[model samples]
Target: MKEKIEQALFEVRPYIEYYEELKKRVEEIASTTDEEGLFIKLLEEEIKKSEEPFKTDLRIFLQKFTSFL
Candidate 1:
């Protein structure tokens, strides 16, 4: 699972700082918890709050995480 997260990080390397911190938090959260739905809900809320490029990036990141599940 760690490896998958690392791979997902690589897959989205070009994204901005917002996602960088979010990704790190995700890694931490994932390692410590099994609450997948919570992450999805969080991401959905973020996606709703975000503007264009970040919104698209978040969607893509969310899609990648969902694929991991």
Candidate 2:
């Protein structure tokens, strides 16, 4: 999973400059066992609450980034 995220990050990071937090979150996801998937749930909730452009960007980033997952 970590390897997949690294690869996806390589492909997608350049397209999204505002991805530092997401990268950090990926690190969090990589280092620990989030059995309940609260990490992802939080992200989904955030996306739902986010305003335009940021929200769409996050959604698109998640979409492309999670394609490997």
Candidate 3:
């Protein structure tokens, strides 16, 4: 399970970087839009979507560690 998680991280690392860049770009693009509320909402949605998987992985890791203890 640990190895599987690591392998998954290796596969997802690039996407994480991609999403970071995308999040930055979204913020920059949103800054230029007149509908600031909509822009902020979309930006947050993009970030939340990208972050959920990572958060899940962290929660799984914490559970694994707690079980080991």
Q: Identify the candidate with maximal TM-score.
A: 1
lDDT of 3 by residue, 1-69 (tens): 334333433444444534454434544645566564554455455545646565444334333323432
Report the alpha-carbon TM-score of model 1 versus the true structure: 0.63
Distance from true location, Cα of 20 in model 2, Å: 1.9
After superposing candidate 1, which stretches have Cα over 4 Å from the reference?
1-4, 14-34
Instruction: Estimate TM-scores for all models.
Output: 0.63, 0.56, 0.31
Q: 53 in model 2: Cα distance from truth in Å?
A: 5.0
RMSDs, each prediction? 3.2, 3.2, 13.0
Clashes of each: 0, 0, 0
Over 4 Å off, model 3:
1-24, 27-33, 52-69
